[model samples]
Target: MNTENDNDEKSMTTGKAQRGPLRGMNPIVTLGSAALTLAAMALAITLPEVSLAWLTSLREALSPILATYYVALVGFFLVFVVWLGMGRYKNVRLGPDDEPPEFATFPWIAMLFAAGTGVGLLFWSIAEPITHFGGNPFSEEAGTPSAAIKSLSLSFFHWGLNGWAIFSVVGLSLAYFSFRRGLPLTIRSALYPLMGDRINGPIGHAVDIFAVVATVFGIATTLGLGASQMNTGLDWLFGIGVTSTTQLVIIAVVTVIATGSVVTGVNRGVRRLSEFNLGLSMVLLLVFLVAGPTVVLCAMLVQATGDYLDSLLAMSFWTGVSTDYQWQFDWTVFYWGWWISWAPFVGMFIARVSKGRTIREFVFGVLLVPSLITFVWIALLGGTALYMELTGTGTILEAVREDVAVALYQTIGTLPMPSEAIALTGGVATLLIAVYFITSADSGTLVITTIMAHGDPEPPRLQRVLWGLGVGALTAVLLVAGGVQVLQDAVITAGLPFSAVMLAMVVGMVRALRDERFAPVPGQKHRLAKEIWTGRDEVS
Candidate 1:
């Protein structure tokens, strides 16, 4: 039976793994991404007013779209929570296994989780609170007690369960259907129950292309932010100017380091990077707790957690009263759309790395654990920054508003070691930033390659390199032109289609699961082939 199953898996692998139009096309995709990035940058520099105007126009167009979609997102998450519970309780397995493990059964899942989330979290841990301090457009009034509470609450809302819910649903749906049913792992596969074979053609191509573009921009944005932060650290520590030139050089150096990792592939490069990041992060957290204002920070954390719990529901569903429209439009709607746009790349990467895990495990692990860590961060780092600012220990928030990276540096200087500690922290943060960016970029490249190759994992190295360089070039262009806001505006716009795509995915998963005869039988050659094609075989 085992021999037969092995042959069956071989048969399925041969039948399904073939190059599609997107396979071996990374160079073209890279060049395309680079061109748009350069163009965006050029407009920002050569025609700043026009660039800003275009951004405004896009925002206006996006407002109505997000308003309509925000309601859908609420409904969408509720549906996801239901299905996630059902999938978990039922012990549903997508491909070959009768029962998947409660947690990620693969070692690489750790690498994926760490690499995908670490950099973004590090960047936002300090920066987002500062952004919030500027204003919570949703608050009853500017700079009120209510405003500060709302600001922190909304930040949690953005980074919490609902946000992860979007990612988990799309990711699990794709993995479940693909692995369980021998469908290709693409956006079109997510809609196969609806579209049938039509998904294998132009429509599928369009979905894949949209995902590719979004992933490219997402990675570029991270690279730029990370570089900018590193530049600020250098300027603060060594009196170097944090100019765009400095940012570009930082990016290039980081890219070189990342390229070496990409060459080693996931096991060596990605895994080591993730472990290093997590360890360094814990060290930083410990350092802050011991060396900074320990008591004040702890108190703020407890207060913030209590407040976040109290306001969680209101913040998540608040679409801004129609009468007050400003808060709804600026904060709630914009963030919803932004999360929607980021969902695809992040979701896809998660799904790819999450094989051998059950739905419930995936949901809680992805949704709950990340949120807990985020709250901790907000309580510690964010809480510390706030303490320093409020007590007049130093102008932390003011410095942040002026420049976020410098604010972090200045705040750190108030601690015991001063220069040595601050420099070391900055260096570690810079290293963490580079690892996360590369992890995200490399994972994206792997996913795109799989989508193009009809779901093959081992894509050509040349294709991977093309994606790496493409992401680098795009980041350089966007940095040079200082078009971060424009890119952000574009992200908001692109997110709407993905929201619809996720909706389609949920419907498809339900249909596929209910069609009982489609279920696989163990030790059967025919079933084994289906399992392999769908990436369900336990061996993989």
Candidate 2:
């Protein structure tokens, strides 16, 4: 009796001790560090000779590795498409009580879109059309009908279905299984289907760590670009010099705003920011409609929509494996690798807010809605720039090659309400960029803490803050040395390791499902407990 009593006492004490490290930490550190890291990296880009060379070499060395990652992503997506379509696997859920989703469907989708794809969408909206108009990078004559149309179509193709598909499959699968199957609601659980027991071992730790690092740099790149451009907008509108100090100031300001939101917790900081960004986006879009060549832009959008539908598949999967190797390398492979690099963070984000959703529903929503919005954005804003460039209305191309931010400003200037338009556009751009980065960074910090602490949701604030500062310091160093482009290259490098990890996650998802369905053994306690809490299954 004494032995049993002592054992019970020891167990209780152990449990209390384990919980001690995770409670009551400051929130500011959790949020500020992420923003700071990105700023540092952006500043680093200013040292073109040293930082650029390092970034380039890092990217080049990782090429073969990234290519393999893309291939694996493609394979994973294809497998899910086949399995789900054929009804080989049923939808799974974790957690009981049918907890409400984190955000409304539209806003949730918008968050994912804005968070992962914002950089490309904004960058290419004006830049791509001009780049394509100059002719296929491989073809002769800048605007040859076949080549030009194909290039635009291909650009849409790259940003369209295939890009989103990779994220959609992994995210939706994980969400469904986690919510339905009583799995821990984290990325590691996504691998449960494949890794089984080993998922709790060294390999699993490595996968999750890779995901954390990838997410840090991936979001950092976006923040660096957006913050730098916001600085340019301030310069154009108010005569502020585009100095490193000014850029750092902008980074500091935005980081504080984001940190405040993050500390407020998810329901307040994250959701409110997402909603605010959406409203701001609408205003910016409205300005584009009212200020720009509304009629011509509309017509171009209609035309592009038609063309996009016609060529999406051919352009997306067009291995072009045989054609102009450089074209494939520069365009197709580059996009594939880019998307792969971004998958883990985006995938994790999707899983976070996507509780209480079905496999089919999550997949379709993530894949289709965001991609469609991107298609329209490019067709509208990018199409307008295309018209301006083609018709000699203004020199959008010269502006872009010279300076990308100026190119956007010049395009906005051509519209009717120039000042108001630029203000609205810049404001929205800054807010969206900042909010998304915050969402990515803080959420990432939170998620990383959870992973490191064995999937605890309310992780230690100290740990969260520590990770946040780490990200910020990394960003600061990179920015101080190289600048935003260098950060971009660093992101590409960071993504390489995570690509393989994401693939393992796919395999884990598959295995977990198979095990639950076929094995005679009872489910694990944690998994079963999650299901009961989330209301996925009835308590027997």
Best by lDDT: 1
* Candidate 2, lDDT over the whole model: 0.59
Instruction: Compose the digit string of candidate 1's lDDT tens values, residues 448-516.
Output: 555544555565666666666756777777666544565556666656666767777877776665643
lDDT of 2 by residue, 457-497 (tens): 56566676666655555655666567766665676666667
Q: What's the TM-score of every candidate structure? A: 0.84, 0.80
| Candidate 1: stretches off by over 4 Å | 1-52, 86-90, 98-109, 112-116, 137-149, 322-330, 516-540
The 0-to-1 C-alpha lDDT of every candidate, in the order given, reads: 0.63, 0.59
RMSD of each: 4.9, 6.5
Clashes of each: 1, 43
Which pairs clash inside model 1? 94-180
